[model samples]
Target chain A: MDRFMSLDRRALLAGLAATGVAAGAAALAPRALARTEPGTVLARAIPSSGELVPAVGLGTWITFNVGEDAEARDACVEVVQAFFEGGGRMIDSSPMYGSSQAVIGHALGRLGAAAPFSADKVWISSGSRGPAQIEESRRLWGVSRFDLLQVHNLLSWEEHLETLFAMKAEGRLRYVGITTSEGRRHAEFERIMRAQPLDFVQVTYNPVDREVEERILPLARERGMGVIVNRPFQQGALLRRIGRRPLPPWAAEIGCQSWAQLSLKFILGHETVTCAIPATTSVAHVRENLAAARGALPDAVMRRRIADLFGTL
Target chain B: MSEWWTYALSDFLLFSPRTYYRLFALHNAALWPAHLLALALGLAGVWMLVRPASWHGRALAAGLAAHWLWVAWTFLLVRYATINWGAGYIAAGFVAEAVLLLVLGALGNRIPPATGPGWTGQGGTDMGWPRALGIGLVLFALLLQPLAGPLAGRALAEAELFGMAPDPTVTATLGVLVAAKRIRWEMLAIPLLWCAISGATLWAMEAPDAVLMPAVGVLSLSAALARSFGGRRGTAAG
Candidate 1:
């Protein structure tokens, strides 16, 4: 019994020693590990005007769904703080994501002047409620002038677009756009891109999900509308698939350290994608994701390699 | 000096290679002492629970319950801060808490049913070293299998099995099985059967990708049911 107790004590001591070593290493590697500033990467000239923004942005789809509580509220504050601190600009939120818009509002209030870029959506299913819905979205985001006002999921597009057009004409919104994901409304996305004079269009375009590559991407490029890529991680499915696979050596050449960076870099590598917004709740994940915006992107060959890697799964 | 407590703490800390290496460098030299203290306390608590004294049993049960509550609270804080306020997150929390409660209940049952005693006239022998070792080994196997075997390749298997799929019927059937308690052991059978049937159907139908979601659904449900019912009953019965 005494021998067993001594062994247990030794084991505990060893475990603690190990934990201390890890924390010290993390503290030392900040410069090597810190995410790159957004401006370092190639910024697309927003074709409407010459406004340049980073090709990679952050999304708050799942991350910003912080319910009414102090800890959740604090987490949202940290997410926003990490995002802006890492030189992130665009933040996309929508009414469909429950309290996402409200959480952004709370974060923005805490962020004050540091809030970089804001783009939100209006999701009204019926054509008749366009005016009231836009007003509500304006009230929700607490911004009289929005950077981009998109018709969420192509809902009530005909009615909402009219108001959005008027808002853009009056300089209430800098851009007018529409978004659809999950390949559910590809036809609608294509039709909107081809026919309408949209300033932007949001769609899902991950390596695992390349359905948009065929039509919508080409149409967006042709129409000169900035494209936003959503579901870049396929909502955590991609990360789970990769598991503990170590990052390939080639990943460092393009500034990709984490799988999150590799995945986001793939989305940003596409020329047509103006910005890709991958969301996360943790500040650590947010910081890791923001690293994708720095350094060189994968060329055509690397993109194919990425696709091949995913294809194996 | 308890081997299992030492193993659990060491294993938990070792799981993260990056974290493990970082902690190795900290030379602060206090971590070892703290871990030793924690392990000693844990072993003492476990010993007290197995003692033939009524007061010790009650005290150990209270300690276990308090420990469970603390862990649950911490998990709740993380989940509530991370996930959206919806039925899914709530349901996930409920499932986690239920599993923890069931496991603790099993452990509680292992403590011999109380009778008039002062470490004498006990109805049965204590779980003793052998049974404790067996329980520890069973747990270690359960924890390690998901990382080592076919389960480790679940993600790829799931994707291949459910190619561009949305079979609501399969999803609904699995959901029903998950909620069913009477056929707890049968829940294990359903998944193995589903995987076999799905594999056969895929081969016979010449639709390799068609059975993906159903196969995945079955596999996941089967694994959960197996864990909930498998060695648990044996431990409780013992």
Candidate 2:
């Protein structure tokens, strides 16, 4: 808590200014305090290290695959800027997302600021090639070391995990884990999670995709693993589906202005979920996603209500 | 158990339609005025299709070969490769096609003899259904294909032209191959493969025109195969 509370307030203030967070707002405190403070970005601890990371991180899937387009690259830089301004720290990406890792590196280089939690994955079919790919990923991000590294989709998990575990032991990597998305290979994923000493595990879990809630989340909790939730909006498909319907009146109590916030709140409401990474291209959307980590989170009863409502929709 | 089968086409698509279209818009902007020249060259190819001169076949193949090489370097390698990992392989295909065209049509003069009357009805040949289909496809690739993007609500700037983009280039090449005196089955290979790839890409992006390229590919391949076998049977009977 002492380390988490020692966030650079001056930097946070500058970021808020850059993101146009009105200084005069009642909840805009000068220092990091309680999570309920409207301007306060919520931070959760990784079970292994207890290093606090912002509850909502940015995802770079289809959103950041802009290639060498200068205009799109600038827009991505701006999105990252806004994400930081909105009190975001973790920015998650994978090599499978074309050009996304390079784009993230470009954005970071342009920003010339240190990313708080730089999370990445090694996603190759060949175990022998994992080190080269990881080196390439690091080169693309321009980071000396990554905060977290996961085996993507459980591809060559045994070999990759051995390398990652060795790297973690050498203090080259902060955390090592495995990931799967869209509810794929749960049995295999669970097997790895149960056997390996993992620091984090990323899985697809949202109101609409709750297969993880059945076993994976519980297992992560039991094994003291940090949980990262992906596909919170089903890659924007969920919001589009439920965007037509009006938000429930009860949603205002939890400070959710949109369905996106409500969805993030439900996912984060899970005790095991350390962070929810939602990919977005728009600055306003990134800010909005980070804001879900602020103010009030949905309670268990509200989570149930949200799930039930989405089930019918 | 291998997990490859668990993946869907959508899983392989790494970028969105907006990003994909914007690539072309930027490509067109970066290489301005080249599109006009390419379009003019495409127009020349169309004219060759209608005129049916003996030299027109060689000229058309050489022109298409140049366009293929240009698109491979400018669009595929320089532009599309940044966003798509598989684009390098696709560009290699274009290069192979260009090389084939240079060897078979331009330098070697290996285009098969006209099986029927020329489009202008001058050559002593029989105008057949396959030739008509070929002419129709050429016109489509030249005139109508560019409109698909704009019609599907994409901006005019993002329109993919024949010489500048791969889709129309391959489509036009297939049409010319099919419309030739006889179908050169060997030359049809890459273009037909490109059609399937293009169609699959669009389908993965959930684009409305997903079926367009594949449908064109299936139609042209079926026509060329049927014509080739029928021609052999006719010669055998005679």
Best-matching candidate per DockQ? 2
Predicted structure with the largest TM-score when compared to the true one: 2
What TM-score against the true chain A does chain A of each candidate get?
A: 0.85, 0.89
Worst 10 residues of 1 chain A by lDDT: A1-10
CA shift of A5, model 2, Å: 10
Candidate 1 residue spans exceeding 4 A from truth = A1-41, B1-238
lDDT of 2 by residue, B3-23 (tens): 778778887888989999999
Q: lDDT of candidate 2?
A: 0.82
Prediction 1 global C-alpha lDDT = 0.55
Model 2 alpha-carbon drift over 4 Å, by segment: A1-35, B112-124, B231-238
Native contacts recovered by model 2: 0.76
Q: Model 1, residue A91: displacement in angstroms?
A: 0.4
lDDT of 1 at B230: 64
Quote the chain B TM-score of every prediction: 0.31, 0.91
Instruction: Report fnat in order of the candidates.
Output: 0.09, 0.76
lDDT of 2 by residue, A147-191 (tens): 899999898999999999999999999899888988889999999
Position A159, candidate 1: lDDT: 86
- Clashing residue pairs in candidate 2 (N, C-alpha, C atoms within 3 angstroms): B116-B125, B116-B126, B117-B125, B117-B126
